[model samples]
Target: MGQPGDQFADLRTDYERHLRSERRLSDHTVRAYSGDVESLLAHLESSGISDLSEAGLPELRSWLARQQTAGSARASVQRRAAAVRVFWSWAYETGRVPRDVASGLKSPKKQRRLPATVDQGAAAAMLDGALARAEESGGPVGCRDVAILETLYATGIRVSELCGLDLTDLDADRQVLRVFGKGSKERSVPIGGPAYRAVRRWLDEGRGLLAGPRSGTAIFLGERGGRIDPRVVRRIVHRALGLTEGAPDLGPHGLRHAMATHLLEGGADLRSVQEMLGHSSLATTQIYTHVTTDRLKRAFEQAHPRA
Candidate 1:
């Protein structure tokens, strides 16, 4: 009965709950979608629209145009458009709107941006530095850092997945990790000997030094002995990469990209790599194949005898 802006508070709360409970989206994802909807509703209120039911394709287009004029990235605009479409679809189905105003809306095509990765030499140097620190310091933090870097490059898991790991998730006898990925999907990723040994060292000596009453079942612990935060993991990765000369500054995701590209270059099959990386789509895994191909082309151009 009130203005559309006034209705937003309760509706947004319900929508956020739906995303978290019904859709099983991660906290980060729920925040992004909710933020996009907030932007749209704010735009509608500024346009003097008192009721959401009155919004149409024109209003949607104008909002998108304003974002473009403001120089929003194409990918951000696309995601924002998708968020609006999903919100309106839900609204229509719930009998709040006569029809989905965003049903006809479309986003611009996503730009093709290749994932960034460190070269093999840089990755090796980083790992070596991590190991050197572990041995030189003989401290809990040093050993944990080595384990973290090894696990990240060896398994290609997300930072959240890494932080979420528990002691039971490590199948040490089998040399595999039980990884919980996006959307709560579970996958078992095999690890090499180095990663296994690094983890073992952390478990045997490092974790106990840092473990407090709050450590619980968490495999990785912060200085206070609580579950490690993803931000700390990112900082560790960035600092480790800094040890390698000429390596691009990258976070956990750069390790993921490097792992995938290195696997493809090593002749691993696409499906196997896909399963290891826990990607839902083959198309996503195929990007690493392109990365491998680009590297091969560069090598051929540099080394071939033909002028």
Candidate 2:
């Protein structure tokens, strides 16, 4: 058996390679996994775990207990557990370890933190307010901003997917827009009429005015005519949220959550919402149901006569 230090380093290197080459994880994800594994290694070293076989269920549980005592959030604990599990599984599969000690380790029970989604009325008002402000600004950037916001809420697409969109991804007549989401998965989401109109205005007036000699086929263009960056999209959402009362200072995902929550509350089925959001698991989409239920309970308590 390899020494604990060498084994840890080899396991980390292999896991990172797996994430990059086989799992095709993004740089952000790769970095997170690396950091989580490193933290686990540091913990193991501090605990005097000098051999791979020395780690057992008790040790794993103790590590988790320590993390909880240290005030690590449940979500963070769960993620670290996942990282360890992946590492041990890879080690076992590759014969670097006799067996996987982390196989029986359970993650902390995470509380479901439902996203803060705007109500339908607030969402409409926010979109309308953005459009009105764009009109007042009377510039290409303003028009483009309006279109970006409208498209996000209309299609329920993630910001990264939206920014990666090309001109051909839009089908105005059918009101469908193709979005590539996490894991490089693609789905076609329906665009609302208002968003379609905003896009048309931007295409006819805004994009043309902004496009310079270096312009490409990107639907959203910067002032200098290159593809708009995700940071700019975030800034636009932040500024737009400031215009509305009671609106949470959420980024693009907040708009996505708002769209999903509103859809579920408006009678859309969970499976459909799941497909639209491109969530590989239905459990992820179910959070919106909890949001709806909470809202319903609040309405019932406020309006029903039973006390």
Candidate 3:
């Protein structure tokens, strides 16, 4: 058997390739999986298990225990646990180990915390303020920022999906956007009129100002004319929300939550909401229903005085 360090490095390369080429995971997910697996391998080496075949359920448990001791959040621990499970399962399937020991592994149940959201009025104020700011600045970058926020809220698409958009993805005539989501799954989502107008303004007055050879087919471009990074989008969203009082300090995902909650509260069916949000499962979309449920509970408590 090769030395533990040599074997682990080789295995991780193959594993990451499998994740990208076969599993078709996003770049973010692949990086996360790679980090988690690296941590586990380091734990095995420190525990004196020289081979993956010798690292069994007990070793896995020990690694998780160490994570807890190191003050890892529950969600972080859960994700890491899942990461190892996938890794060990692959190792066993590919004959790198004698058994799929991680198949029996488990992590803590996901906490049922509700995602944060702003009410419709706050959402309007945010977009309105963005528009006013864009107009006042009288520049293309400001115009682009307004369009980015509107598209996120109007369609509830993920930040990555938004960043991936190209000029061809916009269907102004159809009022839809051809979105490529996780695993490159494509879905068509309606574009609200305001969002469409904002995007058109950006394309007409903003995008051309920033586009360059590095921009490629990307609809949005950075200050340097490269594709806009998701981090920059988050920053723009954060700064906008941070300045708007009575609104939670949130980024793109918060706008997504607001979009879903507003749809549910406006009597949109769960299935339609699920499709709009590009959720793979209706169960995932059902969380927004809980937001409406909580509102009902508060109203009932305030109005009912028979007791």
Which candidate number would show the highest lDDT if scored against the true structure? 1
Q: Give the per-residue lDDT digits (tens) of candidate 3, residues 1-307.
A: 1224876888999999999999999988999999998888888998887788888888899888888898988899999999999998899889999999998888887787889988888888888898899989999999999999999999999999999999899998998999998888899999889999999999998999998889999998899999999999999999888778789999899999999998888889999988888889888888888899998788888899951
Best by TM-score: 1
Q: Return the clash pairs for model 1, or none.
A: none
What is the TM-score of each predicted model, taking all chains together? 0.96, 0.88, 0.94
Q: Which scores higher on lDDT, 1 or 3? A: 1
**Prediction-by-prediction clash tally:** 0, 0, 0
lDDT of 1: 0.91
Off by over 4 Å in 3: 1-4, 303-307
Q: Mind sharing the TM-score for model 3?
A: 0.94
RMSD of 1: 2.2
Better of 1 and 2 by lDDT: 1
lDDT value for model 2: 0.84
Who is ahead in TM-score, 1 or 3?
Answer: 1
Residues 1-307, model 2: lDDT tens digits: 1223675776678789998998887777889878876766666777888666676778777777787888989998998888788878877888877889898999878898988766777778788888888889899999999999999888789887887888999997898898888777889899889999999999999999989776677889888898888999999988888788878787888899989998988899999999998999999999889899998999999999992
> Which candidate would rank higher by TM-score, 1 or 2?
1
lDDT of each: 0.91, 0.84, 0.90
**Clashes in predicted model 3:** 0
